[model samples]
Target chain A: MRLIAIFFGLIFLLVGFRNNQSIELIFPSSWPEPIYNDDNYPLNEQKVELGRALFFDPQLSSDNTISCASCHSPYNAFTHVDHQLSHGINDRIGTRNSPAIFNLAWQKDLMWDGAIHHVDAQALAPINHPDEMGSSINEIVQKLNKDVRYKKAFKSIYSDDLITGERVLKLLGQFMISLVSCDSKYDRVMSGKDKFDEQEKRGYELFCKNCSECHKEPLFSDYSFRNNGLEPDPQLKDIGRMKITQNRMDSLKFKVPSLRNIEFTFPYMHDGRYKKLTEVIDHYDRKIHFSNTLDPILEKGIHFTTNEKVDLVAFLLTLTDKNFMFAPEHGYPKDFFDQK
Target chain B: MIRSIQILILFFSLGVRAQDSIPVKVMYDRFEIQPGKTILFQDDSIRIDVVKFYLTNVVVGGSELSSGLLFDLEKDQNYLLIPISQIDEIQFTLGVDSLTNSNGISGGILDPIHGMYWSWQSGYINFKLEGIHFENGIAEEFNFHIGGFLNGYNCERRIQLQGSSNVSRLELDLYQMLQTLSTDQLKKIMSPGKRAMDLADILADSFFLR
Candidate 1:
């Protein structure tokens, strides 16, 4: 009996030890399991804290003028709102609009064109891009190595003071994965905690009828590449998915961005062509350009009444999670920067 | 007591067997067509600055050997040292397999920090050969980064070499590849496509057992 008790105790202890190794990814029960394999990069508080610090620090950039947070601010749903296109180092404008950086654990590919397959390698694009940070991982590592704060942070987490590109990228990924925004009014309504207003209810009905196929429920995105019939800009003849696949069928098919927090992430689409939700609705309603590889769903233009359009816009506003936007934990680590 | 003694002897024998296996060294030597200071192909004089590629799924004698290794001509440290005996036949892929390319945040040779990985596109640059070739008294740079793991554009090549040795020295002659292409038509190939696939084919053919 004593031996049996000891064996059971040991089993319980082992289970507890395994549970402590991984930090749970806080997400709604309704959502599907995240595509990112947590085993590759197990979540921990120390790593997440280190990642958050790195995200706000401009030292990652060549000129130390731009950080990941420069384009992806906390207040604006982690996306730049002041400009249509993303402004990189030295005031150089990027081709595409900066997408929101929330609920990224669910996403399979990053960027407008689905160029980056993994979230871990996504930071390398902007870091190496001449117009963006204009910096290399080697330069960033050198800078981080010199900093006492970074050295101490890395030592605490990894139990050693060594800082490598893999460590930096993985830690940054941890911070990104922690940016979960599931506390919106829409989420509340789905959870049976709150009820939608009459306007919002009508908007939800219209959204389900017209846009739910692509702008899916729960996540508000199917996350597939589709050419929604926007006329090709002569200046920036940016063929989206075709650039990667080199397939003619994939021409102009950009990743369908999530409509969550659309109220704040203004200047929509890949190129930031539409400034207003009404304009986006207008485009969907009347102005769908026919193409060889255009999405079949968008072939028959979605016709929306002006009143219905107003209701849809009202429904979209419910997606704005104020708690996530203004969360003190997600914001710039003031104590960390202040100490330095 | 007799069973314990037998187990100890078995363990000792296994340890001795493990130590007896020799480490197979895979060496890479880069060379031009002509044996001289300056690398010359046809009329244009060139210089080979760098040559790097990934060797994956290395199988010897119809059995699995080394999983993968990165070989860089510029770096002396980049070489495979496999602990295997009697290499009768060798088969390996020139580029990274599709599985490793899709698998995120791998360590060692496949790490993104190695500079072999394509940041924009989530795939490894299977083969990278960069150098400067002078054309009409003007120095023109040539960079061929071969990679594409997707269907239809998969540039990974399967190479089978017949050899049996503990230490195999593979010779890559850059001159033979340069001879086929004109300086004007093929200056640089950064992204993966038909051009990259064609150049990779040339690179695979350039390898010879020495």
Candidate 2:
């Protein structure tokens, strides 16, 4: 841990410590430190508020109809439940499902294929995608510069009215990192505030034996890329991590998404193939595609009884943090937007 | 004793200011670089629409002094000021380093608003050259946006040049560089790979101290 801190400190020093202030990350004491350090862009209330406003604003899209929340709504733990693939501006469907947006500080890489290395730069992907917002950071900066509200906010927060792409991206990153979801029933159970019933306890044991290797506890993700034995889609032909790495060994590999709020953040999988927990479990049980790059853990298909699947799903529901989903701060900043 | 201490402080300040800083200048030659300006070569006439690249890790006398600088042929901001006086040996990378590319978003020349950053991926476009080449009355467009940080696909080039006496400028023959690039394999290289690495090597070979 000391070595990691020193490494992060060296990086901060090398970058010349661009920002002077720092924000303290508040998570469970037992949870590991986030890979993302706050030294890059110091998180403050005003910056997060600006980011929240930008997230919900339709002006971010080229046609001024779509926003980040268009796909990632807070009510559904920041993932869209209405569709399998993400629907962007002009009703264009994207290739992959929009992943949920909580506990982002823990994620060293974003996107299903783990293309984006940092949360600060992740928004640029969807914002500039032709199927997504179809807007550039340059375009957004120009529009925001003209807005009186934004000008005032920028002046107050940054000590100047100048709005640059760096400030805009950092603000969005701050808002995302502020979304900490560690207040679920599972957390309460771990804290000894509550106890799981008989079926749920059995499900937890099964999960520890099988799923815990990849989907580690607390964060519920080891965050490594793996091929979880799914047949390649003929149309998408999305060779996943291979596209980034240009290596055949990395074929079909995708980042292991955190299972926190798994009950709400579905349909499951990178393509959102399954709509129910039982269907996902059945896929693990009966359908495991063998390939050279397939994860060794899923080589022998998991065999779970029908009753066991039901109990497993019951335990998975304990991960849903309703408090986080309904948090006023995480939602659209109505007060900021309503001022106009 | 206090007066002697004051004189010692003055001498120390003078010693600190004695080291001279020089501005690194990029001098282009053997080409008219304005948009749509035709440069007729053997059997082909090329019209360059855009040319931009990142110059980073400016080293003088084996010591690195600068981080990164974006250079656009159409823009007037062509020189980078560095804290070095002598021009004995100079070394610089033709693109942003892999470390900086992975370190996330930053301000100024490294900002995404500059249009050099790849929106789909998380790396800066190391070198961008877009143009139309005419061969046998046939005009084909070519875009070479070279960048990739991972191993086996890294396109950043480390270039070393023997500097002239008291001269801190580097001259690159743009026509020679373009001539060296075969038109057959020059169409739409927007991603990092073997082709991008090849182009980076060809471009890096074209730099010399002036």
Candidate 3:
């Protein structure tokens, strides 16, 4: 226990002090280095705290009703589990499933379509989205600037009282990048701390055989757009990535989702078409769509036995991290609202 | 895959950037706009209207091109003010800058505004046009919302300015755009199909420098 304490202390010292700011950057050694540079966007404790406060604060929305925590609940891997499709201010339902937002430091693009290139600019989407928060960054900052608590918080970290849109964006990025999920059973197994059960191990082996090509390990996503063999929803008519490229060849291809916490984040796909993991697996096993733009990988569905499917479900369950899900530190900082 | 990919993309986000030290201010439009007064133009005035088309891209007549941050003169505010210039000659696209279009954006550019978004069916409104024209002695309001972000009609228009840079104030002569199209051509465009494509092509060709 003493040895463990000292080891943790050493890690805190090394990673906790980046860019002269005290941000806790203690992901496991086995994980790859983060994509976001601390030098450009410093990760201070004050900034992280501010970002956390902002995440829970509804002032970022047009009305004081919606916040980041609304769609992305902390308990459910920072993504709402109750709703298949996410809801925002005035009960507006967004089409896409709210993705599990962990290990973002390794992510290059955001959203199901990978539309947002930077995490800094990512919040601006939900904030000003008419069907979402529907609040402008300018408007949100103006609200924060007027509030004495936020003004003090801003002054403590950024040194000035001005709450510009860029600062809001950068701070939100800091908080989001900090949401690293390196405590899954897969991570523990790789770290040599925990062992996978026989069923889970077999499921993982099957996963490696069939899913690992696109849903790559470590991060569990190759992050490329692929036509995952699902037929397009007739009502939505979303053309996936072809909207960005204007190329017919790229039609029906959406961003390959990260299957890290697939056990929790359900109502899957861009349109929230599949409600169950078994259904999703069955679709992959049988409903391989034959089209001009279907992913070659999914041209032929993988055949899985009934028992193997149960084993797969067992492996998927190992991804849930109770420590992370119930970390008291990430819960609503009651102290934040006290001053406001 | 994510690590190496992130490195490549990080290089781009960092590399494709202006000097970071100077948080400069760009006065988008200053002299062209006067508060408390709405500017008026003739139906026959030579006008060029530019929109920072969101969902779609900007291409010239045949090729995709860069969209510069040319300021709007009639109204001067520090926002992403759309530019309106005289019809001496013009060149411009209705989409984003090259680096931005390549890397992509989340909210500001792609944020849903007006009635341009196609619900959740598609993503963004790549182009928008609002024009008032004389049709059969009736002044009809014509609105062209062209965008789909993905697939065909990804109209990231490229434009070339033909006129010399003059004073601070620039004018939008609607008449110039009107001169290019007769009442018959103007009356036909509704969506980005064949006829709408022809009007878009005319609008693309109408861009010149003054």
Best-fitting candidate, scored by lDDT: 2
Candidate models: Cα lDDT each? 0.81, 0.83, 0.63
Q: Deviation in angstroms for B91 in model 1?
A: 3.7
Query: Share of real contacts kept by model 1?
Result: 0.60
- Give lDDT: candidate 3, residue A91: 97
TM-score of every prediction relative to native: 0.87, 0.88, 0.70
- Candidate with best DockQ: 2
Question: Which of the two, 1 or 3, has more DockQ?
Answer: 1
Model 3, A261: alpha-carbon shift in Å? 1.8
Could you tell me the lDDT of residue A44 within candidate 2?
77
For all predictions in the order shown, the interface RMSD in Å is 4.9, 7.3, 12.7
lDDT of 2 at A106: 87
Model 2 alpha-carbon drift over 4 Å, by segment: A1-22, B1-29, B59-68, B82-88, B165-169, B175-186
TM-score of 3: 0.70
Q: How well does candidate 3 reproduce the true complex, by DockQ?
A: 0.07
Ranking by TM-score: 2, 1, 3
Query: In candidate 3, residue A99 scores what lDDT?
Result: 83
Q: Please, what are the lDDT tens digits per residue for candidate 1 over residues A145-172? A: 9998988888766647988888898888
